[model samples]
Target chain A: MNAVKAIFLKELRVEFRNKQMINSYLILSLMIIASFRFAFSIIDFSITELASPILWISFFFGGMFSLSPIYKREIEQGTKEGLLLTPISPSSIYFGKLFANLFIIFCLELFILLLFFVFFPVNIPDLFSLLCIIVISTIGITALGNLISAISSNLSQSEVMLPVLLVPVLLFTVIMSSVSVTSNVFAGANIFDVLDEVRLILAFDVVFIAVGYLLIDYILEE
Target chain B: MLKNKLRILVSILAIIFILISVYFALIYTPPHEIMGDVQRIFYFHVASAWISYLAFGVTFFAGVMYLKSKDFKWDNIAFSSAEIGILFCTLGIITGSLWARPIWGVFWRWEDIKLFITFVLWLIFIAYLALRANAKSRTSKANLSAVFGIIGLICIPFSFGANRIWQQYHPTILVSSEGSLQPSMALSLIISVIAFTFLYIYILLVRVDIEKMKEEIDKLKQKVGG
Candidate 1:
C-alpha cells in the first residue's frame, strides 16, 4: 500500500511540475470546442443533436493527447530504469500510472464538460445519470490508453505509434460511450437505456486493467 | 530442397483448385433470385474475408511463438503473415464494398458490423506495420509488434459485438435469427472457402520464403561488416 501510494504521488508530482500535459489537453479541447461552436453558428441545424458527437470527439482527441506523454516522458528522462529499480511491484507501477493519467484526464474532462455546457445547450433532466455515463466511459478510455501508452513508449515513434495503436482497440468504447451519452442528452432515456453501455465500459476497464498489470513487467524489462 | 519442392507442389495445386472453384462459382452455381449476378461476388468476398481471418489467426499464433521463444524468425513470420493478411483483407473489403454497392446501394456503410470490423482490422495491422517500420532495434520492434498483434486480435470479438450491442444496421452473418442459407448458396460458399484456404496457405508460404531470404541478406551484411 505504501509502495502504491508512493508511486502514485511520484507520478502526480511529475505531472504537476511539468504542466505541459495539462496545458496541451486544455488548449486542444478549448480549440475543439471553439471550432465546434463556430461551425454550429454557420449551420442552421440544432446544436443539441450535434453536441454528443462533438463532445466525444473533443474527449477522444484530448484523451489521446493527454496519454501520448504518459510513458514517453519517463523513457526520455531514463526514469523508467529508476522506477524499475524500486522495490515496488510492476502492478503497483501500472496502477499508479493508470490512476495518475485517469485523474488528470478526469479533471480535464470535467473542465471540458463545464465549458461544453456553457458554450452549448446540453440539458439533461438527470445530472446524476449523465455524470455516471461520463465517469464510466472515461474509465474505459483511460485504462486502454494507459496500457497502450506503456507499450508504445518502447517504440521509436511513440507519439505517433500511441494513437495508431490505441484508436482501433478503443473504437468500440468510443462508439458505445458516445451512443449512451447521446441517448441520455437527446432522448432523455432512462438509466436502463444506458445500462448496456455502462456494462460494456465496466468490462473493458476490468480486462484492460488486468492486461496492463500483467504486461507492464514484460514491457518495462530491457 | 525438399521444402522448396513441396511449396511448389502446394502452389500449383492451389492454383488448380482456385480455378475449379471459380468455374463452379461462375457457371455451375445458379445466381440468387434476389441479388442476381451480383450475388456471385459473395464467392470471392467471403473467401477473401475467410482467408484474411485465417492469416490473422496465424499472425496471432506466430506472435505467441515469438514471445515464447524470443526468436527473430517467428517475429519475421508473424510480420510477413500480418502483411499478407492485410493485403487479402483489403481485397476483401473492396470486393465486399463492390458487392454491397450494387445491392445495398452504398459502397460503404458504418452500419455493417462485418464491414466495419474488417476496416478496423485493416487499420490495426497497418498500424502494426507502421510501428515495425519506425522501430530503432530489430528485437524491440518485433517484441512490441508481437504484443500488439496479439492484443489487436483480442479486440476483434469486441468489435464484432459492437453492432449487436449498439443496434447497428450491419447484417448478422452467422447464427442469424433468420433461417440458414439456401442450400445452393451455402454449397458455393463452402467451395470458395476451401479454395481460398489453400490460396492463403500458398501465399503465406511464399511470404515466409521472402522473409527468410531477407533475413539471410541481413545476416550476410552483418557478417561482412563485423
Candidate 2:
C-alpha cells in the first residue's frame, strides 16, 4: 500500500510539476470536440447521435495522446530503471502508473464532456450515469494504455505507435461499451438500459488491470 | 533437403485443391433461390472467415506455448500465423463487404455486428503485428506479443456477442441454421473450407520457414562478426 501510494504520489507530483501532458490533453480534447461541433453545425443530428460519438472520440483520442508520456518520460530520462529497482512489487508499479493515468484521462474526458454540453447545449438525461461511463472507460483505457506505453516506450516513435496499439484494444470492447452507455444516456433511456454496458466496461477494466499486473514484470525484464 | 521436398509437395497439393474447389464452386453448386448469383461469393467468404480464425487460433495457442516455454520457435509460429491470419481476415472482410453491397444495399452496415466485430478483431491483430515490429529484441517481442495474443483470444467471446448484447432491435445480416443449408451448398462449402485450410497451412509453412532462415542468417552474422 505504501509503495503504490508513494509511487502514485511521486508520479502525480512530477506530472503536475511539468503539466506538459495535461496541457496537451486539454488542447487536443478541445480541438476534437470543437472541430466536430463545427463540422456538424449544419447537420443538426440529435444529441444522442452527434454528441455521443464526438464526446467518446475526443476523449479517447485526447487521452491517447497524453498516455505515452506516462512511460515514455521514464524511458527517456533513464528513470524507469531506477523505478524498477526500487524493491516494490512490480504490480504496485503497474497500479501506480495505472492510477496516475486513470486520473489524467478521467479529468480530460470530464473536461471534454463539459465542454461538449457547453457548445451544443445537449442535455444529458442522466449526468450521473454519464459520469459512470466516463470513469469506467477511463479506468479501462488507462490500465491498457499504461501497459502498452510500457511495451512501446523502448521503441522509437512511441507516440504514433501508442495509438496504433491502443485504439485496437479499445475498439472492440471498452470503447464500444463506453459509446453504448453514452448513447443510451443521451437518448434518455432508462438507467437499466445502460447497466449491461456499465458492467461490460467494469469487466474490461478488471481484465486490463490483471493483464498489466501479470505482464508488466515480463515487459520490464532487461 | 527433405524439407524442400515437403514444401513443394504441400505447395502443389494446395494449388490442386484450390483449383478443384473453384471448379466445384463455379460449376457444381446451385445458385441461391433468393439472392441469386452474388451468393456464390459465400463459398469463399465463409471459407476465408474460417481460415482466418484458424490462423488466429494457431497464433493464440502458439503464443501461449511460447510464453510458457520461452521458445523462439513458438514465437516464430505465432508470428507466422498472425501474418497469415491478417491476410485472410482482410480477404474475408473485403468479400463480406462486397457481398453486402448488393444484398444489404450498403457496402458497410453498422447494424451488422458480426462484420463490425470482425473488423475490430482485424484492427486488434494489426496492432499485434505492429507490436511485433516495434520490439528491438526477439525475446521481448515474443513476450509482449504473446500477452496481446492471449488478450485478443479472450476478447473473441465479446466480439461474437457484442451485437446481441447491444441491441435486440438490429438486423442480423447472415442467418445460418442447420437446416438452412441445401446439400449441394453444404458440400461445396465443406470442400472450399478444406481447400482454404490447405492454403492457410501452406502459406504459414512458407512464412515460418522464411522467419527461421532469417534467424539463422542473423546467428551466422553474429558468429562471424563478433
Candidate 3:
C-alpha cells in the first residue's frame, strides 16, 4: 500500500510540476466538446437526445490523451527499468499508475460533463447517481487504458498505436455500457433503473483490472 | 512425406465438402417460403461467423500457452490464428451486409447489437495485427500481443450473446426452441460449417508453417550478420 501510494504520489508530483498531460487533456477535451457541439447543431439533432455519446466521446478522446503518458514517458525518459528495479512489485506500479490515471481522467470527465451540460443544457434529476456512474465508467476506462498504454509504449509509434489498440477493446463493452447508463441517467432514470448496465461496467472493470494486475509483469518484462 | 499427404488430403476434402455444401445450399434445399433465393446466403454467413469465432478462440488459447511457456511456437500459432480470424470475420460481415440489404432494406443497422458487436470484434483484431506490425522486437511482440490476444477474447461473449441480450432485430435462426431451420436447411448449414472449419484448419496449418519458415530465415540472417 505504501509503495502504491509512493508511486501514485510520484506520478501526481510529476504531473503537477509540468502540467503537460493535464493541460493537453483540458485543451483536447474543449476541442472535442466544441467540435461535437457544432457538429450536432449543424445536424439539428436534439442535443438532449445525443448528449451521452457526445459526452463519452469527449471523455474517450481526453482519456486516451491522459493514458498515453502513463508509461510512454517512463520509457522515453529511460526510467522504466529504474522504476522496475525498485523494491515495489510490478502490480504496485500498475495500480499506482492506474490510480493516478484514474484521478486525472475523473477530473477531466467532471469538467467535460460540466461543459456538456452548459452547452447542451440537459437535465439530470439525480446528480449523485450520475457521479457514481461516471466514476465506475471512468474506472473501467483507465483500468484497461493504463495497461494498454503500457503495452503500446513499447511500440515504435506509441501515440498512433494507443487509440487503435484501446478503442475497439473498450467500445462495445465499456464505452457502450457507459453510454447506455449515462443516457438512461440523462433520461431521468435513476441508478437502479440502469443497474444492469452499471453492473456490466463494474464487471468489465473487475475483469480488466485483474487481467492488468496479473499481466503487468509480463508487459514490463525485460 | 506423410505430413504432405495429410495436407493434400485435408485440402482436397475441404474443397469437396465446400462444393457439396454450395450445391446443398443452392439446389438441394427448398427456397424460403417468404424470402426465396437470397436466403442461401445464410449458410455461408453463419459458417464464416462460426469459423471466425473458432479462430479467435484458438488464438486466445495459443496466447495463454505462449505466455505460460514463453514459446515462440505458440506465438506463431497465435499470430496465424488471428490473421485467419480477421479474414473470416470480414467474410462474415460482408455476407451479413449483403443479406441485410435486400431483407432489412439497409446494408447496416447501427442500432442492432449483434452487427455492432461483430464489427467491434473485427476492429479489435485489426488493431491486434496493427500492433503486431508496429512492435520492435520479437519477444516484445510476442509478450505484448499475447496480452492483447487475451484481452480481445472478452469480445466473444458479447458477440455471441448480443442478439439474445439486447433482443435486437438480428434473427435467432438455429438456437430457437421452435426450430426455424428445416431439416434440409439444417443439413446444408451443417455441411457449410464443416467445410469452413476444414478450410480454417488447412489455412492455419499452412500459415503456421510459413510463420515457422520466416522465423528460421530471420535466425539465419541474424547468424550471418553476426
Record all residue pairs in model 3 with backbone atoms less than 3 Å apart, i.e. clashing: none
Candidate 3 docking classification: medium
Q: What ranking emerges by lDDT with the best candidate at the front?
A: 3, 2, 1
What are the runs in model 2 whose C-alpha is more than 4 Å off?
B1-9, B165-180
C-alpha RMSD by candidate, in order = 2.9, 2.5, 2.8
Error of 3 at A208 (Å): 1.2
Task: Order candidates by TM-score, high to low.
Answer: 3, 1, 2
lDDT by residue (tens digit), candidate 3, A6-96: 9899998888788665787788888888898788776667655688788888889988988888798899899998998888889999999
Top-lDDT structure, candidate number:
3
Interface RMSD of 3: 2.6
lDDT of 1 by residue, A84-186 (tens): 8978888887788888888988888888888898889866667777677777778878877887888888887678888788878886645555554465556
Worst-scoring 10-residue span by lDDT in model 3 chain A: A40-49
Model 3 Cα displacement at A108 (Å)?
Answer: 1.3
DockQ score, prediction 3: 0.57
Model 2 has how many clashing residue pairs? 0
List candidate 3 stretches off by more than 4 Å: B158-179
Q: What is the lDDT of every predicted structure here? A: 0.78, 0.80, 0.85
- Best candidate, DockQ-wise? 3
Measured over the true interface residues after superposition, the C-alpha RMSD of each candidate is 2.4, 2.1, 2.6
Residue-by-residue lDDT tens digits, candidate 2, A93-190: 88887887777777777788788888878876778777767777788778887888887786666777888877767766677666666777788875
lDDT of 2 by residue, B85-109 (tens): 9999999999998988887777887
